[model samples]
Target: MEKVFNTRSMIFTLYGDYISHYGNVIWIGSLIRLLKEFGHNEQSVRAAISRMNKQGWVQSEKKGNKSYYSLTDRGRARMDEASKRIYKLESKAWDGIWRMLIYTIPEEKRHLRDELRQELIWSGFGLLSTSCWITPNPMEQQIHDLINKYDVASYVTFFQAKYEGMSDHHSLVNKCWDLDEINARYTQFIEEYSQEYKLDKQKIANGDMSDGSCFVKRSLLVHQYRKFLFIDPSLPKELLPGKWIGDAAADLFTDYYHILEKPATRFFESVFEN
Candidate 1:
C-alpha cells in the first residue's frame, strides 16, 4: 500500500491480504474500484490482470456484461506455499541439530540448478558455499519436496548434525545470516506503524476512520512483515543472539495486527455487502 507502483505487485497483495479470504474471486468492477483507491489506473489494472493471466496466476470469466477473476491452480498453490512461511505464528521446538543440503547438478542442467538455488533460499536455507546450504531448523521434508520438484533428488545429499565451528556462535550465525539488516527492517516497520496504530485505533472506535483507510493500513501492515519471508530463516531462538530484535518485532506486529484486524475486516466485508 505504501511501496512501489507495480500493478502486478498490487494485484498479488490484494489477493494475499484480502482477496484470498474473499473466496479467491472478485468481480472486475470491484477490483477496479479497489485498485483505484491505491492510485492504480483502470488501464494499468487491466494490463496487470492480463499479464497475470498469461503467467497462469489468474483467469478471467465473463458473466453477462461483467467480468470476474480468480486465481488459477498454479496461483493458489503459490499463495499457499508463501502463506506457510509468512503466517506461521511460531516455530516448532528445535532439536539442536542443523539440516544441511549438499547438491551437485550436472552442468547441462544449469538452469534447473539456478532455479533450485532460489527455492532453497526461500525455503530458509542459507548458502554456506556454492554447493552447500544449511538451516538451523529441520528441513528434511522441505529438501525432499524441493529436489523432487526439480527432479534433482539424485544430485542432493542431506545431513543432520550439530554445528562445530571455529568461531563463536554469534560469528557462525553472522556468516550465514544478515541479522543486522533484517532487524533494521523490524525497527523500520515499528517506526512507520507504531504512531498511526494508536491514533487510527481510536478513530475506529469513535466511528471516524473510514473503511477505505482501514483496508489500506491493514494491507500495508501485512506488506511490511511479509518481506521477512524472503530474508528470515526463522532460526530457533537458541540459535539467535541475545536481545534479538525479531522477538520484539514479532510482539509489536501481533499487537498492532490485533488492533487493526477487526476494523479492517469490517471494511473488507462491507465491500462485498449487497
Candidate 2:
C-alpha cells in the first residue's frame, strides 16, 4: 500500500488517541504501541513525536531513558476543535438501518473497486466484510449520491440495516489532526502577515495604505482559501457563500492565487524536498 501523510489527518490521529486511551498523558511506550498498531516503525514514531513537540502541540519530559508526553493547552484546544469537526461530519442520528452495500463489478473493473472502496472510506463508511460496507450514521442519501456520482449503480447493490454498532475509523482518525493547533497557527500567521503588510484596520484606516499593497491582500486570500479547502469539496454549495463582507471572496482568492501561487509553491517544495 502507498503511504500518505496528510498533516491534518496525522495530527488528528495522534491527539484522538491521546484523548481516547491515555487521557492526555501519553507515555513513550504507549505512543510507540499505538504507532505500531498504525503500521509505523520505531524511527517514524520518534520523528513524529519530535516534530509534534517542536510544533508546540505536545510537551515531553524525559525520566532516564523513558519519555512521558502530554498535550499543551494549545494542543488540547486543537483536539477539541477536531472532535467537533468529527461529530459534525459523522454523528448524525441512526435511522435504524445499516445501508449495507456490495459491488459485483467485472474482473476488468478491479480499478473501479479500489476507487469505490476509497470513496466509501472517505465518506466515513466501514468495511464489514469482503465487498460489504456499513456506517453507524444514517447516510443512505450520501451513499446513493456517491453511487450515482461514480457510475457504479449497475455494479452495486444496496441493502437496509442488517448490522449495528459499526465502528467508524474515519472519525477516530480525524480526532488525531490537532485542529486547534492548525487553527492557532493560521490565526497567528494572519495576524502577523496583516501587521507586516500594514493592513491592520487601525493602521490601514488611518492613512497607512502606503504599506497596504497587493501583497497583504494576497496573503489573506491564500489563508482563507486554504481554510475552505480543509472541508470536503463536495459539500452542498449553499453551505458556503460566494461572497463575504461585500467582497467576492472567491474572486479575490483567484487573484491571490495568480500572484502568490508560484512563489508559495516553490517555497513549500524547497522545504519538503530538503
Question: Which lDDT values do the candidates have, in the order given?
Answer: 0.79, 0.51
After superposition, the stretches of candidate 2 with alpha carbons farther than 4 Å from their true spots are 1-11, 17-21, 89-229, 232-274
Error of 1 at 98 (Å): 1.8
Q: Candidate 1: minimum summed lDDT over ten consecutive residues — where?
A: 1-10
Which RMSD does model 2 reach against the true structure? 17.8
- Name model 1 segments beyond 4 Å from true: 1-5, 61-66, 106-109, 166-170
TM-score of each prediction:
0.85, 0.33
List of clashing residue pairs for candidate 2: 11-176, 11-177, 12-175, 12-176, 12-177, 13-176, 13-177, 78-180, 98-161
TM-score winner among the candidates?
1
Give candidate 1's whole-model lDDT.
Answer: 0.79
Per-residue lDDT tens digits for candidate 1, residues 1-274, read 4435577877887788778887999987778777776788889899999899997899998888988899997688668877776667877777878788899999999999998998888778888877899888777776777777789978989998777877766677788889888888878877877787788778878989777787777776777687788898888877777767877777777777777788777777766522
